[model samples]
Target: MTNIEKKVIDVTGLSSDQIAMLEEIVAALKAVSQTNNYQGKVSLDRLEETPQPSLTLEQRRAFLQLTLEERRRLLAQQAENMVEHYQENTEWQEFLAGGIIEY
Candidate 1:
């Protein structure tokens, strides 16, 4: 795999809540991925065995940094039953939590 360069995230424009939410999502995903109940494509054992190409902090933050309108779209797309679906869809949940709706 190709290596990705790391850079600092310019979070100056983000509100405290947004930053907190972004961090919260990443931590939640990682934590859930470690759980025995996790039913995602990638297992905890596999994760531990693999040298994954992790995203830079800036890249993760940038991926999650969405405009207000974008947030609205995500909400609309996932406002109801989607959360239930996300519980089983690890990748989509992570993407949604990162301000991306993979549809």
Candidate 2:
């Protein structure tokens, strides 16, 4: 078999959806390499219009009243959910926490 097929065979544990995403990335990279100027848009479509765990005024007040550790746990949970759904990492935890704390 060819090297590309062999490399693909070596990959493990990715779902079909993940593989599809990687293939799309590879195609985009190839396009950029060939043309030297990719016109592709970087989409924020993955970031929904509404934030997750949307809070009402009362809910926001209650969340603001939570102790720092409690707030951290909630942010961690949200980060975990994001990781599960979007392959996003926990690095976003601090950023989210900052937004909530500053509000």
Candidate 3:
């Protein structure tokens, strides 16, 4: 039997088909991991959960005092952070599985 090699991947740049391929590989791993003592399952629930953040009083005050340009830069950074965590829509999974989600 061959060993499975795993690597840390940046999923943000992966297309939907690449994401689907990863999912199928994971499912196969989980199936093989089952034995007399254990059954493995993975949850993708966080895909739908939105992040919740609360600022401390000092942080809020600092944010409020930022100049317009500084605020724009900060907001742009925050938006990019959010987009980096975005989930692929479910409807595209089938198309993705075929490895050609787009023409």
Worst 10 residues of 1 by lDDT: 1-10
Across residues 1-103, which tens digit of lDDT does each residue of candidate 1 receive? 1112333556698899777766664465455334423232354555532333455676456446766664565446434434544565567555567644546
Q: How many clashes does each candidate structure show, in the order listed? A: 0, 0, 0
- The collision pairs in model 2 are none
Candidate 3, which segments miss by more than 4 Å at Cα?
1-53, 87-103
> Could you say which candidate leads in TM-score?
3
lDDT of 1 at 86: 53
Per-candidate local distance difference test: 0.51, 0.44, 0.46
lDDT of 3 by residue, 15-75 (tens): 7865665555445434543331111112366534333344445454555554466557656
* Cα-based TM-score, every candidate: 0.29, 0.34, 0.35
Global CA lDDT computed for model 1: 0.51
Model 2 RMSD in angstroms: 17.9
**Candidates arranged by TM-score, highest first:** 3, 2, 1
- How does residue 68 of candidate 1 score in lDDT? 65
